[model samples]
Target: MKLFRIVHPLNGVQRLLLTVWVGAMWAIGYVAAPVLFAAIESRMQAGAIAGTLFSIVSWIGLLCGGLILLVQWRARHRGLSRVALSCIIAMLIITGVGQFGLQPMMADIKAQFPAGVEMSGELRSRFGALHGISSTLFLIASMLGALAVWRSAPTDL
Candidate 1:
């Protein structure tokens, strides 16, 4: 009973964190990135801007996800569903793969080319493939975030 009293307030905090994290993911991936690509004249410039935004959002996810996991861990006995926890973990892993893995390879490929010179043939194909994988991973993470938020709700729990 005492623990419930302490953990109860954290429920609101957890919900807020989830909302912020998932909302950022949707806003950045679906809205802002596309707008940058369409509105900006230079593909390289647009990509750079979009990449920075993605990096920022990824860090936001890491922070929010870490805090949410800590809160869930603390309140584990309070009927928190394992599904929600699993979703968060999966989202984190996706974020990691996108950030640390695919992004670096793509960046390296980009670095190989000169400032205005575009990649050709094999390099272009490889970059395109990596970007596609990154985008797919981002989509999966966004969906998982939505699932986590839904499953972690007090009503659902």
Candidate 2:
């Protein structure tokens, strides 16, 4: 009983939660964010500063997720040495960077809604579609990372 007590109750929960979160974020970032951030125009995909704000929020979210990964590591590593600390850390860093620093560099990504910039509904829809594709890829990567950790768990290690 004492030995079991030593184990984290959320032994599997952390990775599961991570998987779910990644999927959810991918959907939000790729689907919801663009829809909400960009404005509809008749011909071009034009958006306001809201898109930029979304990017900033995204960076903050990634940074926060990295921090959560640290907590997950400390909580789950007692008997699971095969799931190395360094690998998890590295994954967190990579994801954090991509989420935080990469999305803001789009060619037409404006800082805010310009007073009179013309945009099209199709463009915003296209942007959302592309964002969805990228986020789906990101979600896949996160799932693979979680699966790697799970598969690496050794009975003795």
Candidate 3:
């Protein structure tokens, strides 16, 4: 009982969650997104599907990251806790901006110029700029997540 008490309930679960977060991110973003675009005849359809996947992945990231932070806190690993918190914040910020800010703006731009119509050059340029920013932020969050997982691992030393 004493030994079990020392072991947090979410000990190994944190590792699993972290694995799922990172794996899904890479698999969906890199592999599935491209495949979706290729398989789908319409760019709009492909974009919608990809965006939904990204949103789901972002939620998963938030859940896993939050739980991992809790686990780190329970372990009293202050440094690890800090790292986890930072990673979670980065993930949340990236996801929020992409979902709420960029996605909406892109949708508005697309709406302004429906299918078969030439999109406004200014709107197109703005959408492209937002896409680039979102992509960079997402990439940074993904890398931070990987780093957080590495730092959370048990160190034999």
- Backbone clash pairs for candidate 3 read none
Best-fitting candidate, scored by lDDT:
1
lDDT of each: 0.86, 0.50, 0.76
Q: How high a TM-score does candidate 2 get?
A: 0.44
Q: Arrange candidates by TM-score, descending.
A: 1, 3, 2
The RMSD of every model to the true structure, in order and in angstroms, is: 3.5, 7.0, 4.0
Off by over 4 Å in 3: 1-7, 70-81, 115-118
- lDDT by residue (52-127, candidate 3, tens digit) is 8988998787777677767767867543546755776677677677777877887788888767565658887887
Candidate number of the best TM-score: 1
Better of 1 and 2 by lDDT: 1
Residue 144's C-alpha lDDT in candidate 1? 85
TM-score of 1: 0.89
Q: List candidate 2 segments past 4 Å from native.
A: 1-7, 29-64, 79-91, 107-109, 112-157
Candidate 1: minimum summed lDDT over ten consecutive residues — where?
1-10
Question: With candidate 2 superimposed using the best TM-score fit, by how many Å does residue 121's alpha carbon deviate from the native?
Answer: 19
TM-score: which is higher, 1 or 3?
Answer: 1
